[model samples]
Target: MPLQPSSAGTWLRAVLLAGVVVLLVSLIVAIILGASALTGGKQESSPKMLKWKDRGTTRNLQEVILGRCYSYVTAHYPELRDKDCLKIWESLKHAFIYKNPCNITAEDYQPLMELASHPIPCNKSLFWSKTNDLVHRYTKSNHNFLTLEDTLLGYMADRISWCGDPSAPGINYESCPKRSECESNPSSVFWKKASKMFAEAACGVVQVMLNGSVETGAFRSSSIFGSIEISNLNPDKVSAVQIWLMHDIGGPQSESCSGHSIKRLKGVLEERNFKITCEENHRPVQLLQCVNNPDHADCRLCSSNVETP
Candidate 1:
């Protein structure tokens, strides 16, 4: 026989129906949360997109070139005004823009070089091989001496790598060919052209700071100083080449005035009819090194000797 529903049975059926609804709602909420978690994980792992306008390479090129130009002109070259700085930037840009960076040669920078060229005072020029830091410090301390980097163009571009991509609209900040990777890379070409100009301008008793610690001979023929500067020095213009052989105070004095490398350098100068003079452990450079390390034995020796090259 069919059974009639009681109040208790009816209540039990209603309770079961409510429980199913609640469980379904809970499962839907959990699935939504899991999808959100997965999306967040993907976002965190993905690389960020860089906007073209916000590229650091382009911004740095503009700011540093412009700022350095202003400071350099104001301090050393009063003849150049603000307009000249803008011209310099424009000229520099013309060298590699719309061209393959690796294909750029020293000839490509001729326009820029011509525009940026300025006279370096006679006997004020300094050159170096494997002694960039020390030479720069020496130049900075001694107002009488100037290096290629002290000039406007070199000052703006020193220690910077820049290149352009033919396929791209602007400078390639993401990557650039290394000096060893390409013969005519933008950085190498700039320095090569600049060094040639600097060497050409050298006059009177030009100074050269060479590293005494170098095992391969301080004056390598392949170096910028040897290849570019030394070759370009006009015997008629330059009266002498003063070699400052700098050695570390601690020791390992590998190359010096009597070393084979230095002898070769002297021979090269003499062949060109240029008088050569060399001094070992050049005092000014040693003293500068000592300033940072007064406690070192070398610094103590420097104080007693107190000589200049």
Candidate 2:
């Protein structure tokens, strides 16, 4: 004997099954959505964190520039007011903002150069290659020579890296391309432009300090001094180029006044129709070294010799 089910019972069972199927589908969809949200969150958070960190550094740079400008002008250039400092900062910003960090060229900085440009006194210009620390110390201690870094703009921007992002409104401090990585990077372009201006403004006699201990010798055709500054020197304006061949206190002198490389540099200057002179261990440089290291035997000899280069 078989018993027949009631219509209501059968209808109820169908309804219950449909509801379970719908619930299962909804659960699967929710799980998928939850996973997607977590993945998207991870992907977006990294760049945001990087951007935030970089933004802070960039703001710090702005403050540093303003402070350096104020300090430099107040101490050395009293004629320039705070307003002038503001103007300089604004001009500097306009040079590289809203551009590709790696694509900025020296020409792009022309406006800033013109805005910050000031006259460098004749015969006071000092240039150097591979002698950054010594040259800066010499220039600072003896105020008679003015290196490119002595200028207002150069003083403010030295040893800092800054570049712009086309997507952002400000500097790309986090990932600015290095000078070695990109020739047209903002830092390199700036130095090139500034060096050119410095060189062009050089008049009368300009003293250049070159490293005698370097295997490349006192002059490298690739250095900023050799490639940019030397070529930019106006023969009519500059009477002579004095080369100071600096060496280590110890021996192993690779280059000197008569080294082939020195001769080549001399020939280059003479071909440019400018009077050229070379001296090994120029007196002022040796004197400064002696003052820094009084006990070294070489320093003692330097102090005893008062001969001019």
Candidate 3:
């Protein structure tokens, strides 16, 4: 077998080359298995693994917020023209970014609220319960009344859904949690904090528009208007609470100014030592509703024969 030295050297080199090929194959398999384990055998995350289930975060959030803030300062409240819209956007982002969506607290929004704070003049604050559309329409047509949406803080973030995640890009665009899913949901917490601030700043005579047509009654103690706004109103600043209990133009009136719910509201205000006034189908509000149903019975001129308490 020791015939030739050149032949023996060639055979040894062939053996070494075969061993290197085996080693390279093992390394490639190890790399692939490690990557699979890291991602749980999936190339991308499943939708079922997303944090929220209701709706995804709003698209173009930054642009929309900045636009609204600038518009509000320039067109609506020019007095706030000095405010830094960019800083406000930053504060809002800081409140929920890279955090648990369900764990965001009202305190997280404190900076944003403070940054957007402004005075609500006397006799202009308008609160509403179960009368969102009518109240907003009324406020829009009659500039004297200002709802939460009319304010700088609410204006910027109104009708938008947003939440943060512990993942890359920070915000979870797949979905956002509902208030029922978690009490500290970012949107709910923000609105609660903003509503509280709005209520506290209300001065002079405040107005509240309630839907009397609802079978559940016009006022609920659990509502933001009931739980937050009415409770936080300053007795020293606000002289009275004027409640306009409105009913649908063509719908039945389930709760009047003298209904049990109205009486309950009256009792609450009295207990808090704030003067109260109640009017059913407030003429101005009813008139606005009439615009759409001009041919309906309730839209007639005689509909102004409203009940009062």
Choose the strongest candidate by lDDT: 3
Candidate 2 lDDT trough over 10 residues, lowest sum: 46-55
Q: Return the clash pairs for model 2, or none.
A: none
How does residue 133 of candidate 3 score in lDDT?
94
Once fitted onto the true fold, the runs of candidate 2 whose alpha carbons sit more than 4 angstroms away are 1-59, 303-309
Better of 2 and 3 by lDDT: 3
Candidate 1 has what TM-score? Answer: 0.77
- Per-residue CA lDDT of model 1 for 1-309, tens digit only, reads 555678779888999999999999999999888887988835344332222222224447878888888888897778865437787888888888766666888888887887778888898998888888988988889888888888888888877767776655657777677766667777778899899989998988999988888888888898898888889999999998888888866757897587899889988988899987888767778888888888987777663221222
lDDT of 1: 0.80
Residue-level lDDT for 300 in candidate 1: 76
lDDT at 128, model 1: 84
Clashes of each: 0, 0, 0
Candidate 1: segments with Cα more than 4 A from true spot: 1-59, 303-309
Off by over 4 Å in 3: 1-49, 302-309
Sorted by lDDT, highest first, which candidate order results?
A: 3, 1, 2
Q: State the lDDT at 119 in candidate 1.
A: 83
Against the hidden true structure, what lDDT does model 3 obtain?
0.89
Position 118, candidate 2: lDDT: 83
Tell me, by TM-score, which candidate is best. Answer: 3
